[model samples]
Target: MPTKRDLLDLQFMDARCKLIDLAAFLDRIERHEGEPDFRLAAFREALPILLSEKPNRARAVLEALSDQTPEPIEAATIQGAFGAPQV
Candidate 1:
């Protein structure tokens, strides 16, 4: 069985992956503005990370962006697309 620290680390990694997925979902939403289902699905994926005991920093950035007027999607360009980071 994994130690507590290992489990926490795995949870953190999962949260990071969820953030990446949220970014992709956001990109898709930007491309197709009419899909509320897609946006809801993305929000569902992101909800865990947002409500986590230790919130993911990247997700926090996106959440802050989502709150502003005109939306960050319209204001600033996202630098990275979804994929596992290079080793």
Candidate 2:
């Protein structure tokens, strides 16, 4: 297994790029004049998980954004997913 430093050396740039991209995405969202929706709300809620000392942030974040409904809906509203729950 790679050491912490070795892993950072290999992944730092890609991680930095993703961080910057996320910041840019938030910037664009802020610049728009519209009401915030579930997707934005979910994304904001997941942000703190990234900073927490969690062993599995990815799974936590995925669950945070996922629909937790135990039962199926009567019908589909759209052909594709909204990327966030409609709640």
Candidate 3:
């Protein structure tokens, strides 16, 4: 059985993947002119999903951002600000 920590980690990873997909979609929008309006609207709809109330999702995004070779310290700072797990 997966421990609570493991479950949390997995949830975090899933959320991060969703965020990465959102970023790629945004990049596509930025790179292309005459993109459909619906595309932009869809991207906007996904924004809240990527930044949902779930802490694991946020943590996952932060983890992936921190893993970049350049290491975005801002992500780490945000994660740290959330503090440790509650009892």
Best-performing candidate as measured by TM-score: 2
Per-residue accuracy of model 1 over 1-87 as CA lDDT, tens digit each = 999999888798887897798689767767885645443554555456655677475766466335333434554355763322111
The candidate scoring highest on lDDT is 2
What ranking emerges by TM-score with the best candidate at the front?
2, 3, 1
Off-target runs (Cα >4 Å) in candidate 3 are 1-4, 49-87
What does candidate 2's lDDT look like per residue over 1-87, in tens digits? 999999999999999999999999999999999799989998998899999997999999998888999999999978988777778
Model 3 Cα lDDT, one tens digit per residue, 26-78: 78878887845543453354456564777676555444433234534454435
Q: What lDDT does the true structure give each of the candidates? A: 0.58, 0.92, 0.56
User: Candidate 2 vs. truth: CA RMSD?
Assistant: 0.8
Q: Which stretches of candidate 2 lie over 4 Å from their true place?
A: none
Candidate 2 least-lDDT 10 residues: 77-86
Instruction: Assess candidate 2 and give its TM-score to the true structure.
Output: 0.94
